[model samples]
Every structure is written in structure tokens, then in C-alpha cells.
Target: MFTKKILIDLDGVLNEYGKDKFNENYIPEIKIGAYEFIEKLSKQAELYLFTSRNLMLATKWLINNNLDKFFKDVTNTKLSSYLYIDDRCICFKGDYCNLFDEIEEFKPWYRK
Candidate 1:
């Protein structure tokens, strides 16, 4: 019944992800404000947790954090959605200019 589908990244976006360590069995604690943010967003759109980690692991993380109810699914693939909320992305402004500089200068919020 949602009018929009939002794909939200699990690590840096929703959880503490300052480290590059990759483990299928481990996911960090939920980021501050993430629970409230997701709760609020869920009222406006359907949310999907997008991650490179195992879907079952991600789902379990959500459940552990009591956040599973806000998401429609956990997916590794980028599904069709109204917006993709990722911390590792740069919004393209329809110009190739400054793209390289932006890429080189880019740092996820956690890094800054």
C-alpha cells in the first residue's frame, strides 16, 4: 500500500560501519537515530534493507535490534525503488565535470 519504495543500505547508513572488516556473522550496532529514522520513513514508504552481507544475517540483525518490522525485505541486489539511500554514493548532478575530484575527495560520513 506504500506509494514509494526506498532502498536503504544496512551498514554505513543504518549501523555503525567505520571499519572495513567484512564478516558474514557479524554486524555492528545500529546507528544513533536509525531506529527513529526508519520508523518515521516506514510510514511514508516501503523500505528494503540493501546490503552485501548475507540476507539472513542482515534480517537477524534487524530482528535483534527490533527493527525488522520496519523493513519489507533484505536484499543484496539493487531492486527497483524510488530512492537508494546509501552512504557510499555520490549524487550525479548530470555533469561529468567535478566527478573525479568528488570521487577522490569523498569520504563516508563516518570517516569525517
Candidate 2:
């Protein structure tokens, strides 16, 4: 397999998230299609679950969900990657003028 690094967020991305913010010892539910999504992506890229939470907790969750095999690592740092699949992000196509509006209107899918 080619080296295509893809960093994915955990709490609100792979896992089903609620309004509660990311915290330790509180593992959110696994989002629907998460394992399938990971399975497909694993074929095309080196996936690293990027989260702000503790690695041990995340690891346990991943293992329970049968997702640990698909990911190369769980990271807090953003390493070099071809793409970042995150739930909390706004695509900026170089339109700097509309950035403020986008930010203000930005609500993660989990929030909605």
C-alpha cells in the first residue's frame, strides 16, 4: 500500500457524539457506518485517529468497536497528511472574505 497519511478525528468524527464536549473517561457512541468507513479508507491511506482525549481511552474504544486494526495510530498531534477528515471543519477555498461568516455559522454535524 502507498503511504497516504490521513488523520481523522475521533469524538465527533468516527464516534457518535452528543452536545457534551470531549472529555476523559467518557466514550461517546460509535457513529453509524464508522467501522465500514474506516475499513474502506484503510485500503487507500494510513489512518491515524486524531483526538484531544487520552490515547488509552481512545484505544479501548477503538478496540471495542473493532476499529483498531484500521488505524495505524491514535494521535493528538497533526502529522503530515494528504487529507484530514474531521467533523469540526469548514472548507476554505481561498475565500478569505467569507471566513468570518463561515466561522460564525459553523456548527459541527453532531451539534445539529
Candidate 3:
């Protein structure tokens, strides 16, 4: 059996980020349905917590929220994965020709 590797971001994907003022040691509430999402995904793929936040704090947050079991690791380095579920990302088509234009025109769905 083969499970697809997935890297899921923490801040805006799993956590209700920007809902409260930033705190280094505190992770805000989990996003609605985040647990359910992870639970369902965990059953189908390998999950990794890919974030720039502090690993210790993130681990504590996961433990507190009872979500520690779903993830294999918390990492800042990009690892091998089939998919990456992040709030702020653009899907690339391996064409560098339009990369600059794409970046220049990209907006994270918040401006609209």
C-alpha cells in the first residue's frame, strides 16, 4: 500500500491564523473543520506539518489540540511530497517563462 506524502502548512491552513494578535508561544484556535480535514487526510496520506513557526510551540499546540498523532514531523525544510496544502501558494506548471509575470500578478485571494 502506498500513501501519498502531503505537506500541510500550519499557520493559515490548520490554525485560525490572523484571527487574533500574533503570539510566539501561542497558536490560535484550530480552523473550523481542520481536525476533520486532517483526520480524513491522515487516513489517506502521510501528513507533515510544514511551517516557519517554532517547532516546539507548534508541537505543543498540536498536543494540546489532540492533533499530534496525525503528523509525521514539523519542518521548515521542504521535503519530498506529493502534495502541499498551503494557504499562500501558487501552483507551478514548470514553466519559468511566465514565472515573473505570475508572481507579479499573483494575489492570495484576500485582495478580492
Candidate 4:
């Protein structure tokens, strides 16, 4: 049993996602450093693959990339986790003042 649970996003976080149009049935190749990153992170916490895509497809992608061993499971729902690692998230600093602007200006790292 792991002490911490981390939710990791699949698309932009693990794979080269922004270059191609969205396709539910397809997952792009793993991103550079992704395998090593996951391998390292898995040692620290219970990692779960979090995605809106089909779980079966995501699992297949993980298997093809030989990354399935690092993850506990693939889930679409936001489970209870210590942290969420995603390319499209904006950290909330307990202030709503700048949130709207941040949302308006926000772009994933790949797009920027």
C-alpha cells in the first residue's frame, strides 16, 4: 500500500498530444522523458492514469509504451488523490481575483 496517491493525466502529460486532432481511438507516442518520469514517480507514490479518453484505449497505450506497470489503474473519474499532475491545470491560490484572467489567458505548455 502506498502512502500517497497521485493522479497523472495521459494526453499532454504523457504523450505528444497537441500536434494532432483529437481522436478517441488513438493515442500518440509517449513524450520524451515520460517513461523515465513515470518509472521514478511510481517509486514515490501510487500513480493512476487519469484521462477523459476511453479507459481501454488508454490502458492499451500504456501497455504499448510499457508504462502500465507504473500505474495502479486508468480512471476517468477524479479519485481522491494527494496531487494531480496535468498539463492543463491552473493552480488555485485561494484567490478568485486573478482566476478569471488566468483562465482567459491560460494555455497548455505545448500550445505556448
Assess every candidate by TM-score: 0.93, 0.91, 0.85, 0.96
Using alpha carbons, what is the TM-score of model 2?
0.91
Per-residue lDDT value at 47 in model 4: 94
lDDT of each candidate versus the true structure: 0.92, 0.87, 0.87, 0.95
Please write out the lDDT profile of model 4 over residues 7-84, one tens digit for every residue: 999999999999999887899999999999999999999999999999999999999999999999999999999999
Better of 1 and 2 by TM-score: 1
Q: Rank the candidates by TM-score, best first.
A: 4, 1, 2, 3
Name the candidate that leads on TM-score. Answer: 4
Output the number of the lDDT-best candidate: 4
Q: What is the lDDT of residue 46 in candidate 4?
A: 94
lDDT of 1 by residue, 46-106 (tens): 9999999988889999999999999999998999889999999999999999999999999
What tens digits encode model 2's per-residue C-alpha lDDT throughout 2-111? 68999999878887677567567888888889889899989989999998888999989999999999999999998988998888889779869999998999998856
Taking every candidate in turn, the Cα RMSD to the unseen true structure, in Å, is 1.5, 1.6, 1.9, 1.1
Write model 3 residue lDDT over 1-112, tens digit each, in one string: 8889999999878987876777887888998899999999999999999989999888888898889999988888899899999878888898789889878887654343
- Stretches > 4 Å off in candidate 2: 19-23
Q: lDDT-based ranking, best first? A: 4, 1, 2, 3
Clashes of 1: 0
